[model samples]
Target: MLLILLFFVAMWAGAQNALAGGGSFLTLPTLMLTGMDARAANVTSCVALFPAQIATGWTGRDLSRGAAGLSLRTLFIISIVGGAVGAVILLLTPPAFFARLVPWLVLFATAVFAYGSFLRKPGEANAHLSPRGAMASQFLISVYGGYFGGGIGFLMVAALTMAGQNVRIAAATKNVLAAVMNASAVAIFLFSPDLHLAQALVTSLGATIGGVVGARLLHHIPDKWLRIVVIIIGALLTLGLFLRAP
Candidate 1:
C-alpha cells in the first residue's frame, strides 16, 4: 500500500517538476512516511526522480538553451561541481541539524519564488544579469538542488527568467539543469547505506511516465498561468513543510 502511494506521489512530483518545480515537497514526505529517515528520504527522492528529470529535459531539449548572459556549458559545469559539493555537505551534515534546517530552507525558497512569480513586473521580463551574477546564481541554486531539492525548480526558473530567458525556455532549461545537478548528487547517494532501492525503483517508474506527460504540457500552457501555478505549489509546499516541522 505504501509503495502504491509512493508511486502516485512520484507521478505527481514529476509532473509538478516538469510544469513548475515543487515536486520534491510531495516526494520527500512520502519517503519519510515509508520509514526512511529525513536525510535518507532526501537522497532517495533525488535518486528516484532523476530519470524523470532526464526524460523531461530530453523532451524539451531545443528549449534548454541558456539565458542571455549564461551559456549552457557553463551552467552545466557549475551544476556538476555545485551538486557534488552539496551532496558532500548533505552527507556530512548531522541528521538533526538537517532536520532543523529543512523548514527554513523551504520558507526561503517559497518567498523568493513568490516575489519573482507574483511581484515582478511583466515589463521587467527581459531584465538581464551580468555573466558573473548569472553563474553565481546557478551555482547556488544547483547546490541547493543537490542538498534538499524541494523547490529548486522554482528557483531555477526565477533565476533564468530574471537573467532574460522567456518563462517557457526558463522552465525547460531548468529541467535539463536539474537533471545535470541531480546526476552528480545521485552518484554520491548511490554509495550511501540510507538509500532504499525498492522505493526508488517504484517511484522512478511513475515519475518517468508523468515526466512525458508534463513535458508535453510545457509548450501548451500559457506562461502567465504556468507561473501562477508554480507559485501556488511553492506556497502550499511551504505551508505543508512548516506544519510538518518539529
Candidate 2:
C-alpha cells in the first residue's frame, strides 16, 4: 500500500508539473518515506519525472523562443554545460550536508516561483534584455535545475520574461530547457549509488500517466487554483523539511 500511495503522490506531482510546475516539492517528501535521504530522494525524483518533462518539451517545441540577440542554440548549450557542472557538484556533496540545505533551497525556489507565477502582471513584458544577461541567467537557472529543481519551471518563466519574452513563449521555452537540463543531470545520476530504481520506476510510470491526464484537463482546470495549491503545498513541505532538519 505504501507503494500505491507513492504512486498517487507521483501522479499529483506530475499533474502539478504539467499544469503549473513545482512537482519536486511533492516527489521529494514522498520519496523520503521510502527510506531515502534528502539527496537520494532528489536524485531519484529527477530520474522518475524525466520522461514527462521530455514529452512536454517535445509537444510544446514550437512555442519555445530565443532571447533578444541570443540564439536558441546558445541557450541549449548553456543548459547542458551548466546542468553537467551542477550534477557533478551534487555527486560530490555529502548526504548530511544536503539534508540540511534542502529545506532552504526548496523554500527559496518555491517563494521565487510563486512570486513569478502570480505576482507579476502579464501585461508587463520586457523583450529587450541583453543576450549576455539572458545567457548568464539561463546558465544559473540551469545549474539550479540540475542540482535541486523544485520550482524550476516557474523560475525559467520568470527569467525568460525578464529577458523580454512573452508569457506563452517563456512557458514553452522553459519546458524545453527544463528537460534539457534535467537530462544532463539524469545522465550522471543513472550511475549514482543513491538511485533507488524500484521507486523510480513506479513513480515514473505514474508521472507519465499524470502528464497525459493533466494535458487533457488543462482547459478545464482554473490556473489560479492550481497556483494556489502549488503555493500551499510548497509552504507545507518547506515547513516539514525544516522541522525534520538536524
Cα lDDT, model 1, residue 220: 83
Question: How would you encode candidate 2's per-residue C-alpha lDDT over 13-90 as one tens digit per residue?
Answer: 888887877888888999999899999999999999999999999999999888767778888899998888888888
lDDT of 1 by residue, 1-246 (tens): 999999998888777777666677678878989998778888988899888777777777888887656689889999999898899899999887787787787678667666765686777666677788889999998888888876677678878888888888987898889889999999999999878999999888888777767777878877677657756766676677678776
lDDT of 1 at 242: 72
lDDT of each: 0.81, 0.88
TM-score of each: 0.85, 0.96
What is the overall TM-score of model 1 with all chains considered together?
0.85
Model 1 RMSD vs true structure: 2.8
lDDT of the structure predicted as candidate 2: 0.88
